[model samples]
Target: MSGADIANVCNEAALTAARHNEEYVKLHDFEQAIERVIAGLEKKTKLLSPDEKKVVAYHEAGHAICGWYLEYADPLLKVSIVPRGQGALGYAQYLPADIFLYTTQKLLDRMTMTLGGRVSEELHFNSVTSGASDDFEKVTGLAQRMVLQCGMSPKIGTISYTIDRGQDMTKPYSERTAKTIDSEIRRIVDECHERCKNLLIEKADQVELVAQELLTKEVITREDMIRLLGKRPFANRNDAFDKYLASKDEKGDD
Candidate 1:
């Protein structure tokens, strides 16, 4: 975020503290402020039916569970079923590491994490919903970049294609190559979706636990995740992210 964004967040956080009649701004106030800045204000007045709420809870839980298990996926910070922004019915936030480069496995893991919500809906409800439109968009973009720009696809040799988004001109490749690119993108996304579906199936019990908790509380923190799913398996995870959470926990104890 830019300096202006930071200033806005701090200002909003102070306003949140004032609204709560607190003598000082707290870490949670800043957290809420950041959420407001990123997700827009919470839509408490926007109501959902019982069935819709249940689907949302499970969908978010699927994301959290997938990120929790994936070795290269970002560490989950929070998950919530409470409606936010204009179109978001639920969301899963992750503490992404400060890394410059990404490996093929890492990218694939992230794609699987992105597909978790949709796969979860399919597994549990035996149906899919338009709620996954954003996920599909993100996954498709990443897969295209991986194949066309990054040359990560084995089928397509290492060749980077520059796409000028400003122009409606034809792609700088043969029609046959375009077909191959489309096929490669579909292959990558389908593989990630399968991986996500398998992971959710294996951890079905934990998904249920997290979903039930979300149904009751509407929000679940990192602490809640650890309690429900146990520690993440990866040993070399982000230390700074862990320390931030620890600091928040200590402040809550005070």
Candidate 2:
């Protein structure tokens, strides 16, 4: 039966019990049932293995640190090594904010964050693994967003180049323009990869520490991040490049 039908049944039962002077039958039964269901689901949350959890923590910590450090991205909220549904392994939560326009530097920094997790794995494990599958997906999506959605692409010009039905895909553009776009996409990916590599290299020690904390706590708070880093990266971030970072830091949520 529908939830409303069940509620109606409960209501009738409660009214009958009340007529017989039974106690505690006047409560909001539906709300109480929903709360119990929610609590049960919450208790069923899954977790990762020790090594995998550590990997997730450091991986996400890398992104959080890079975000706070860049001064152009969003401030780090909570960092979790906890495994979520769909084999997430771990996740880093950032404050959701709108992006109207992106500067070249901001776009670069975002790409760095998207790839930060995979780079962390390579740095820590002395070898790469499939744990970064998600990172690759995120990076690809970010690159496409930059080139196709955000117009940060230099070759495609300020206008977006999109596919429409009955349009030419084989002869999409001049051979020269097509080649230029390919070059631009590669440059964008290469530059972001380098940025992530450099950031991870510089924070090599902190990365280990953060990963260790994840192994211990399964989740790292913003305060945990600050304590591990000794200072916030947002403090000295570039204003023009990291304006959003500073703004999020100021608001101080998550």
Candidate 3:
């Protein structure tokens, strides 16, 4: 995925890097390029006020904390409260697994992490915000896919009612089946939301700590994360990245 993203950048990013006294684009340039492609260019001066900044800090801190505690979540890379893209007040970056493979547990954890922001808002402010619009869209899509496409829904059996691309004009399943699928998807997401919300509440102090620090620094790296929240859940995609880094160090004799 990242390789394809880099390809799409052509040499424009490399050229931009050269202007900074770099002879060639390094991996950091590509990393920044990818983040820009997804999250939009970082808006140096944000539109957020002091209170808004605090909310955003906690909102993003919640995401990082959930990812840290969840065994199946993608490993944390960084968390930031600086505004980026359209309305992204803040975001948590993760080192996702390379493979497309996903088990039910992993999917659930992903949904939980997505709900983290809303959960945090509700916990800290007794309200919610539009910050989680993208998260809910992602959660809904994953739940529906799990049921309708992946056939991971035991209640729905191993039946798939997937409509092919551009086939939305036709009904793939009956009205009753569609209703059932929608209900199931809602149930899955609602349950995960409550579970994640409770976890955030339980770890309220840690969440507050991370939020306070985020408001101070505006960005937190993996080492900063480890000091604040301890090590992530044991061995998964993050561990895989570690192995890759090790190999690179060996080859470069670093």
Candidate 4:
């Protein structure tokens, strides 16, 4: 978050504390402030039908399960079916690793993780909702960057086709190269989609477990996930987040 964002969160936290009749801004207040900043205000009045709620629960569970099992995807922090923001029916939060560089495999795993929700919808419902639009948008942009800017596409060679955002009508590369780039991007996303489908199928039972829990509770934290699925197989990639979870456990916070 930016400096201004941090300031806004602090201000919001103070207000939240005051609203709760607390003398000091507590950690819970700060957490509520951060959630408001990141996810907009909680929309308790925006009610979903039973069917819609089921879809959302499964969608978010798909995200959590994928991240939990993926070797390089970020660690799952929380998953919720609570309606928030303008259009988000549900969300899964992850603790991203503090690293500057990314590997091709890592990027692929991330894409696969993003695709999990839509794939899960397809597998379970035999259809998909518009909820997956944001996932597709991010996946497409990442795949494009991998092919055009990151040189992760072997078929396209180590070439940078990074376009200037200001120039909307000009092409730095030829029409044929543009076609090749499009094809490469499609290939990358398709492979990731298949990987996600396979993983979700292999762990379908775990997805059901998490989805059912989400339906009952509306939210599930990292500790809840560990209880349901056992410990994550991969080693910790974000020590700070692990430490935070540990502190919460030590305090016996719900």
Candidate that would win on lDDT: 1
RMSD of each: 2.8, 9.6, 2.7, 3.1
Q: Tell me the number of clashing residue pairs for each predicted model.
A: 0, 3, 0, 0
lDDT scores in order: 0.91, 0.68, 0.84, 0.90
lDDT of 1 at 250: 100
Q: The CA-based lDDT of model 2 is what? A: 0.68
lDDT of 3 by residue, 170-249 (tens): 87788898888888998999999999988998899999989999999998888898898776657544555677778999
Could you give the candidate ranking by lDDT, starting with the highest?
1, 4, 3, 2
Clashing pairs in model 1?
none
TM-score, per-candidate, Cα-based: 0.93, 0.69, 0.87, 0.92
Query: Can you tell me which runs of candidate 4 are displaced by over 4 Å?
Result: 165-168, 236-239, 243-254
- Return whichever of 2 and 4 wins on lDDT: 4
Quote model 3's TM-score: 0.87
Candidates ranked by TM-score: 1, 4, 3, 2
What is the C-alpha lDDT profile of model 4 across 1-254, one tens digit per residue? 78999999999999999999998999989978887888888998999999999999999888888999988888887788999987888888777877699999999999999999999899899678999999999999999999989999998999898787585868889999989999999999999999999999999999999999999999899989999999888664544577786899989965
Of models 3 and 4, which has the larger TM-score?
4
Model with the higher lDDT, candidate 1 or 3: 1
Better of 1 and 2 by TM-score: 1
> Per-residue CA lDDT of candidate 2, range 140-214, in tens?
767766776578875686766564537555644677876777777778888888888898899788777877887
Q: Higher-lDDT candidate among 1 and 4? A: 1
